[model samples]
Target: MIPAGFEYHRPADLASAVGLLQEHGEEARVVAGGHSLIPMMKLRMAELGHLVDLQAIGELKGIEIADGTAILGAMTTQHELIEHADLATAIPLLREAALQIADPQVRYLGTVGGNVANGDPGNDMPGLMQCLGARFELYGPAGTRQVAARDFYESAYFTARADDEILTKVTIPVPAAGTGYAYAKQKRKIGDYATAAAAVLVGTASASVAMTNLSDTPVWSEEAGMALANGDIEGCVAAMLAAIDPQEDMRGPIAFKKHVAAVILRRAIDSALSRRA
Candidate 1:
């Protein structure tokens, strides 16, 4: 299905994009890779009078590492991220998660910024970002503001983005020495959304566990992670199940999703801890 008619604007610079968004407000939608937005537009779930394309903005298209953080530009493609050597070495969790995002064709066109900024609970990156303690950089007429990954998503398919703001970059902290990370998801097929998933990053003493498709928003279970860190797998599993409230849907029943989430959490923990051992 073709999307509804919309005025297209390619902004060459950040200022132009922000100005356009400020003027158009809710009537406008930002298009990066368009992998997520275009489908919704075609379904009429998203209607925009104007599309402010960010592809022409050159600064928003590269991978750079500095100050012990991987700064991924909002427009960086998933394929680009998968092949980045620095990211591969410094933050393999992101690289590992990126490879599982979608098929190769979609990965070539899907932007990391679009994935997380869309705030879809089914998307893989949000949970991984939460585990990695990533920071989102929001740019607008008010200048730039940094939002922690934990605070970025307000609900499923909803974000902290204001009418006049754009997400410009994702800043991931360098993991501490001996830290380990893993991401696991149960999908029906390649390129399919996760039925249930877990992303875990563990240090010698603590762990961060984030799950997707189990609630209104991606949920990071601090209590469960603490239990896992204490070497109480049963307690950790119980806590995880208690924290998730997956709804019954065509994807799977709530009980099954909760069960799958627990299984994935166990695998994620094993994968993460094994690397450190």
Candidate 2:
């Protein structure tokens, strides 16, 4: 289906981009890889007066690792994540998870910013970002503000980012030496969204666990991570099971999703622990 006609804006920098959004208000929407929003627009679910494309903004594209932190530009593609040698070394879990998102063709076009900013439950990056304790940087007319990934999502298809703001980067603290990480996902096919997915990180004295597609929002279980840090796998699993609220879908019944989440999370925990030094 053809989308309703809309004016297109290609801003060369972040400030101009923000200005366009401010001028257009809810009638304007920024697009990165055009994966999510474009489809909605085509279906007329999103009727926009202006479509602000971020592809021209150099300020929103790059990968930088410095001072025990990794800064990923919002426009960075999944293929870029998989291909960067230094990024892969600094955050192996990122590459591991990126590989699981859609297929190669989609990865080449899908942007990390789009994946996390949209608050889609099925997207893989949000849960992984929560497990990594990443921070999202938003640029707006009010200037810049940072939001914790775990605090960003309010519900499915909803996030803390105001319509006037554009997500510009993701900042992640580099895991300490010997921190082990794993992303376990279960899906019917290569391009299918996860029926259930788990991201786990086990450090010398810290642990983090988060799940995807089992709830309206990504489930980041602090209790479950604490249980793992204390070496109680069953406790971790039980806590995670208690946290997720999966609804019945074409995937399966609620009970089946819970069971799959449990099994997948356990596999992730075991895999992460084994990789630890």
Candidate 3:
């Protein structure tokens, strides 16, 4: 299906992009990689009069490691993250999560910003970012504001971002030297959206556990993380599953999803902690 007719505007800078969005207000949308939005537009699930393309903005495509954080530009592709040597070592969990998103073709064109900022409950990156305590840099007609990744997603297809703002970058605090992490996703097939997925990160004495596709927003189980830190593996898994109210949708039955979440949580915890031993 063809996308609804729309005027395209490519801005070479963030300020111009923001201004265009502000001018168009509800009638315009930003396009980064277009892997996610274009498909939705084709289905008419999204319709807009104008598109503010950020591709021409050269600054929004690099990765920087400094001050104990890995900052990724909004236009950075999944392939870039997967192949970056520094990022791969600094946060193997992020690389693992990136590898699990769709297949080669999709990963080549899908930007990390679009994957998470789209606010789709099924995308694998948001929950992973939450588990890692990442931060989002948002820019708009007002100014710039930083938001914790966990607070970014309000619900499926909705976020804290105003219609006029663009997610400029994601900054992940570099994990401690020996920190352990894992991302375990259970999808029905190679390119399928996960049925249930878990991303876990454990520091010396602290931990975090988050789940994707199990709720309206990426679900971070603080209680479960605490349980894991206390060495109560069973309790941690139970707490994580408890936080979820699985829906019986076309994806799977509620009971089955709950079971998958439990199983994946267990594996994710084990994988994350195994690095310590």
In TM-score terms, which candidate is top?
2
Q: Give model 2 RMSD, 1 decimal.
A: 0.8
**Models, CA RMSD each:** 1.2, 0.8, 1.0
Select the stronger candidate by TM-score from 1 and 3. Answer: 3
User: Best lDDT goes to which candidate?
Assistant: 2
Residue lDDT tens for model 2, 1-277: 9999999999899999988998988899999999899999999999999999999999889999999999999999999999999999999999999999999999999999999999999999999999999999998988999999999999999999998999999999999889989999999988999999999999988899999999999999999999999999999999999999999999999999999999999999989999998
Candidates' TM-scores? 0.97, 0.98, 0.98
Candidate 1 TM-score to native: 0.97
The sequence of per-residue lDDT tens digits that candidate 3 reaches over residues 1-277 is: 9989999999999999988988988999998788778989999999999988988998788999998999999899999999999999988998999999999998898898988888989889999999999999999878999999989988889999988889999999998888888899999889898999999988879889999999999999889999988889999998988897778998889999999999988888888899853
Residue pairs with backbone overlap in model 1:
none
Pairs that collide, model 3: none
In model 3, the worst 10-residue window by lDDT is 268-277
> All candidates' lDDT scores?
0.88, 0.95, 0.90
TM-score-sorted candidate list, best first: 2, 3, 1
Residue 159 Cα positional deviation in candidate 3, in Å, after optimal superposition: 0.9
Off by over 4 Å in 1: none
